[model samples]
Target: MSCSCSSSTNTQNELHASIMQKINNHPCYSQDAHQHYARIHVAVAPACNIQCNYCNRKYDCSNESRPGVTSYKLSPEEAVKKVLHVGGLIQQLSVVGIAGPGDGLANPKQTFETFSLLKKYAPDIKLCLSTNGLMIHKHIDEIAKYNIEHVTVTLNSVDETGEIGSKIYPWVFYEHKKHRGVEGAKLLLEKQLLGIQMLVERGILVKVNSVLIPGVNDEHLPFVARKVKELGVFIQNVMPIISKPEYGTKFGLDGVPSATHKQLMKAQEACDVNVKLMRHCRQCRADAVGLLGEDRSDEFFKESFADKSFEELAHHYDLNQRMKTHENIETWRRALRAANGKINQEEATNKDELSSNGNTMLVAVTTRGNGLINDHFGSAKEFLIYEAGDKAIKFIMHRKVENSYCMGKENCNGTYPIEEIKNALSDCHLLLTQKIGDCPQKELESIHLTCDESFADEPIEISVLKGVRKHFFTAS
Candidate 1:
């Protein structure tokens, strides 16, 4: 009996270790892995079978980089060659993926062919595929055969009734016919959930990517997160809808703004109860390369950045260096103040009414750069201040502060000098960040400062406006 018990325990331990090994190197699914591992995507698949109201795959020379924009497309053979070259150069490359310029499974021949070459050339490397989930069910056999371990299904909504789905996805081409409106969305959702279930049953790790559309699926994504969690998805990445009028998608042409940071956080707060929300994804392009948060595709492909050494490339996109407080701190402050003054000039319209009611507020956002609330309160080196009222919001200044919290051991009994940090933010009414600790939360409250950590990677202007509206006007 003792021997049998020991054997059982050993077996369980080994199984747990195996699972951890599978996820420890996947940057998209494992947030911790992002610090060390790099992933490269090959845009071998360009034919999408479904029409998302937000997607328009037009390639141009524009310096802008986002999902659905791949400057170069390669066949399976060409893709394998590029992968080999990149792999040889970047030693940390652990995972190779096929995300689209279109759905991976939609162009099955090219998709699987790329996988086949990858397995042959670099069998040790992890294989991942991202699909819209419309045709994922059809390729399960090949997926398993290639030992594809991670799969991402873009499931915007799980509404079987199509009430919300019809608005997000206008049409899907499935089987031999085209599906439109609510019927199309219903069909896509069915297949998406079914595909996820099949992958789970096959012992494959699944991640669900849901684009948080402002009015259409923003509220619905948390529910989708809950449902996918039930279907055995390992994590959920709720991305903001990146809309541009030039792309000419219905949502963009109608001027639907991207999901602001606050909105994503609000939705994530709900989803957190049911599923683990992924906050580290860069919403990478199909041909994206290098570290998860930073895109080095241009350096690798576009000759403008020029220096192609892996170390030099990584240094070029380093966040700590990018977020460093400029040496001439006063000059930086002056520039920020001048920019705010111009914005204040245009926004002086409805300020009197809001100011009279004490609704005009100063918001301090913890960010890393590029107008995103991408830092944690405990890790923040400076806070970007913005003045927000009923009608307008503008960047005002950057306040430098020490990270007083999260410096000591959690269980250790010690004094935390939160007041030192509080003094810098005393004029601000609210604080926004990716996350905060309970002790710090209570400390901020003691000073009558509202600390909100629900938001991440949001534009400073939009985040300030939304934070003011949600925290100030909602109760009134």
Candidate 2:
């Protein structure tokens, strides 16, 4: 349950140093940034034996997908091609994570094949994988063989009977039998701890992601943290439980999310360890592609996979295209955007409907970033808004250029006036812009609009309409 770190002039040392430097210096990991969008996750696993109440295999952590949402399932070879295609387009391929709508280990054949192919084709790519840790103990050798540097296991509680704990995973097929309740929890925990010990012993970094649920495991997180740190885990990411009320879980009832930043911070302070908090972590989609804070759904569609039809890709991956919901469209959009690809507006209709009718959509778009779209938008001097029924309106008054800002000259194509932009959105049912902070709240409320903060451009969405709310804002 302990690990030793010694500095040496070995290749591993150099590699670790390089990776660490990249993480620390990268814009995606910057402390001041409100969102981090550097990593990409691919859900190659389609089935899981164990389940947690807080998790719905139907959807991803970001709530971008529901269980059985996608119709695409690529073979490892196809996945590798897709990674290469995406990596080539994205600047910092910081981490390639294999998380799941199901357990990664449960799909060992696909998981390992994907990892092996990534190593073969994108060796320099930093590797990451998330699991429930039920089958991690069995895959330590394979994980190490691929030189995986980071691994995350979702551990909500230690003791099965403790507060903040639930026997959510009723049963798991272990040796082909249903192991339920405490037995399943114990089995999962045992494998988790063993996996942590093995990874640390082998010099691989470990991170434990605990979803803090109030009255459930909120009180028990300190125990989880202390235990993980003792096992030489480097970071403890205490994530808030994302509850979906429509999914019929006790957790998401009352429309309130579990825990708060303040509560999680308090727990971290109490844990009293060298564990670092992953504040910018985005519980991304299984097939998410983007930098740390930005979403590139549009880019992914336009660029990386533009040649591949959505239906064809879905069928190839064995995704259920027929039952594919609005969630699937968003997931596709997000993936495309991450890859700097362009999404055909005409084809995005079905996906657009997945969004709520009254939902306000804000797109913090700029052409100035150090990416491919620099030429698409002429200058970074003006911001533009494309409403559903109106022509693209330009905000000339808000023009100002800044340096090193993700939405600025080096990072974005340009800037634009805020007031002028708002005026243009006045007639639209919803306003989608690079940001809305500069816009007057009275203007947004006047339009009966709500906002989607996940547009990757705007950092905040304050509704002027009393009681109306905005959800999922990702600050750049």
- Quantify all predictions' global Cα lDDT against the true fold: 0.74, 0.53
**Model 2 CA deviation exceeding 4 Å by range:** 1-37, 59-71, 160-165, 248-250, 253-257, 272-274, 298-476
lDDT of 2 by residue, 1-476 (tens): 12333444465689767656545423223322222225566657888877567665553234343322333555666666666666655534446777775778888999998898777666556678778787878889999998877787888777855223334455657778877777766776777788788888987777788877776677777888778877877777776666768765555665546555446546655553445555445555566667543445334432445466434443443323312432343354355345532221322222232233423333323433322122222223332222121111111111222221234565554544434434434433443333435334344566655433234332211111111222232321
Judged by lDDT, which candidate is best? 1
Model 1, 113-170: lDDT tens digits are: 9899877766657899999998778889999999999999888888889979888777
Q: Best TM-score goes to which candidate?
A: 1
**Global Cα lDDT for candidate 2:** 0.53
TM-score for all models, in order of appearance: 0.65, 0.59
